[model samples]
Target: MDTWLKESRKRADSAHHVVPIRSGVLWSEALMRQSMPPSTADPDTSRPNRIPPDVPRNMHDSYCELLLPFASSPELLEQYINASGGIRTGMLMEHLDSLAGGIAYKHMLGPGVEVLSKDQGFYMVTASVDRLDMLAPLYPVRDMRLSGQVIHTGRSSMEVAVRMEALEKDGREQTIMLGRFFMVCRDAKTHKAAPVNPLKLSTPEDKQLFALGETHKDRRRLRTSVSLDRLPPTSLEAEELHSLFLHVHQKVFGGYLMRLAYELGFANAELFTGCHVLFVSLDCISFAKPVPIGSILRLSSHILHTTSSEQFPGLIHVGVQANVVDVATGKEQTTNDFRFTWCTDHNIPLTRKVVPKTYKGPCGERLGFSEELLQRTLTSKTY
Candidate 1:
């Protein structure tokens, strides 16, 4: 793990890179306030225990930890493969998204609190994936553990951290993937943003995680400014790219976009790492503009950085950007920015390193900004 950290840092600092900043934009307070309409003026006195403002500060109220022990069965992998024989990252992402939603639901509850359907109900949806660090590759027969917890909260948003761990046959465990998911609460009926119960910070670690969540929010504001507009890259480094174009006739889901980006990223990985690459992590993923029906969605993906190791060969980091294009005006609106990390399947030994070229032009600019964002969120030497 220490060696992997050193190698990643070395690649990041290598001269093969050139990378951006824009003035940060603040979230609309008024919009947030309006999204959360006050509940009934005259509450039902019969159910006084429901949705109270004051809740106890207990671990049960603010934290959710799940442990699932299993292996990525051959059948599971077979069900999620791309044309290149690599597993589709979308399958894993969808699972994690569901898990994050469960954590948020648990954290938002008061002790023994349950709401009847007639009463106000809160639902959660993934707003963004702040950070994902893939520490190692996953394959069949590898024992695994998946866990999630709510680290912080805003008026209507919850910051949750989830991890995937690989347990060795010798009774040792190592984290293979770590991620931060931002979830937003919404009214079940109105389907609009709604207030959620605040998180109760107790342990020192909880406080620390909460502070980290705050920092991510700050960085996201800066990222949003630069992601407002995007142009096709002119750099020769972008020549070996992978792309996907979709025409939406109905409101598109964020997961669909994530899946497309994952496909393109994995495709880019294959250009150098071969057909056996496995997903690592996704960093600084922000869904900038929601795509309605009748929009043209384009995704362009390229390798950003890479390194090789005797123990784990052909590690590649990929960056992806999505745009919504106007077919008539030929204008494009940048929709999302994502950084994905993957490695060659352990079963396959890499005789050579997959080193990506130094990025230039628009691609370089985006890569530089992504690298900066990655440094801020990554604190551990290894996943």
Candidate 2:
């Protein structure tokens, strides 16, 4: 294992000059400037080879940019309420890290191998995979090679670079996302610290990707802290509103605010279960404050926008706020705020539901209290 590690490191260091071009660009244009293919120099080569034609580049750059705050789709918010699952931010982090690990193993490890062990770390508030998965299916564990560079190495942790891409129908590939993670390995059962295998980075391209991943780590941190202070309002019945209050925290566990957001849609129409949550992607989540275990919380939500796709018939955005008042002392405090995305598919189409044209607070007509109350709704994506 030690000898293989040393040799692999040497090879990786030597390969540093071969940089990978960004996906979704004109590959022929870029490769044309480089040396001939290795196959051309082999004496046994018989068939003629040709460079593939260039492809048009029409891509959404949003996938490439990292670290911007995200908002949940309306469908996701509603699902939160309907399913009563409580998805947390930490779970989301786990999912992201797991996906990253899968990508690294699939791309780096040779055949006939399984991941024997894996470890991760975090630096500058961003996490990364440090130790490679040991047990691989196709390749000997000691013969495996990784291509990314270390951007930051700490006393007990390090951050390495990574990126994702998808091939388009037009024979073009697009750069999806780039970021870094921290990693540290330990004994699986005892949970004691372990040493990292010596790794040698070879290529400049690998170093560049690793560096980009580190930079994106900061951007992702920033995006996760957005505020939602600009959502509109909808009306609800007293009974339905009370039910919503009971499950504000419960629905958040599902990771999409849209589950709860769709419930608000039903309340707005004075109808029960009129809307359904279909698809949801977390845009942002923030636990600005916590809700007490037992409290009668006032909950409210509003629609952001709606569109239709072939899979889902309706799409919408809903924002929610939770507030509680102490009955004994008459003291009240805002507890939680969130935003969500919602969508639904039902046999019946939704009729235009009438929403209250004007909002009035608990007290009648003395001041523009209703508008103030509505404005208090948490609409920011930061969490």
Candidate 3:
């Protein structure tokens, strides 16, 4: 695809004593210049091959691929192998973040421009990860390739889509995962929002990808409008969250997953480059009623179940309640119940079990297991 930049493709400009201008070039001619005194050339010694801000950039112009030759190098593959003998997903996530940054910089600089000079006017930083969908499990036996391009751009933000493929021994590439990273360009000097080049869509694939990016933007806006923090869930969404509380599975709470993606990504990056942070499960027991706008919510949680024996360990069922006060009467009403189970670097230890002293405590637990709840759901035409 002419996307993988190789060492052989790197060339030097002897006339200006310039180093190879490519993404992966580790060394620059400036290394030698660093040993000598700084040269004060005329201030206006215009930088070479600088693409203008208004120039429309093609999707392919920012295309780059990185090959992880796991099959060929066993020693190197050991670094990425997890306890389950599979490639570590967290490391791949860190790399995806890195690749997205490079693609954004590539779109700003021309195709072959290597160094991100301070005078380049703009630089890119990861604002957030809009989405990360793992289509299939990754295999440790196969070599892998990661590739991505700048799909769409706004005034200061751009969408970078990355793909991971498992390269089979027989020369087949199976898609393993797909992700979209949102990057923001800031003026290098001022650190304010900077304009990004427009994307030039030339083909069907380009147009389709660009459309997906636009859809991402729209969906992000929609979620922000009705986010769990700002707005309450509808009856249907609340019911789904009830099922999520029962099972603590991902399929029922995709919205919460998207909301938590940015935090999870950065949390995993803490301590070291590829530290692991497992998203154990987010459980909401019940969304009884929506909190009205401008209402103050008093939130609290109670630990429910924990086995005294350590046989089936590392789980503590928590019930969190959201109470809102009536402004007129000054009476608090319980409106939400949440069950959270977490397993990451930090641990919350529970010795035996918890007994809630409040009037609603034992009743809430009993209601969770009541036969009437099941009967009511069964009688309903739609739940």
Best by lDDT: 1
TM of each candidate vs. truth: 0.61, 0.30, 0.53
Ranking by lDDT: 1, 3, 2
- How many clashing residue pairs are found in candidate 3? 0
Between candidates 1 and 2, the TM-score winner: 1
Clashes of each: 1, 72, 0
Judged by lDDT against the true structure, how good is candidate 3? 0.55
Q: Residue 186 of model 1: what lDDT? A: 72
**Model 2 whole-model lDDT (C-alpha atoms):** 0.33
What order do candidates take by TM-score, descending? Answer: 1, 3, 2
Question: lDDT tens digits, residues 1-383, model 2?
Answer: 22222222343323221222112324454345235564453333232221121211111000111121122234443322223243222223333344333322222221112331212221111121221211111211111112233343333334444332333335453333232345433332343443332223344544443354455455444333221122322345434332332322112222222234335543443232265443232232333333544566666765533444454445444445556678898777654444444445352344543244444311123322223222222221111
Candidate with best TM-score: 1
lDDT of 1 by residue, 283-322 (tens): 6576555687557888888766666555445667778999
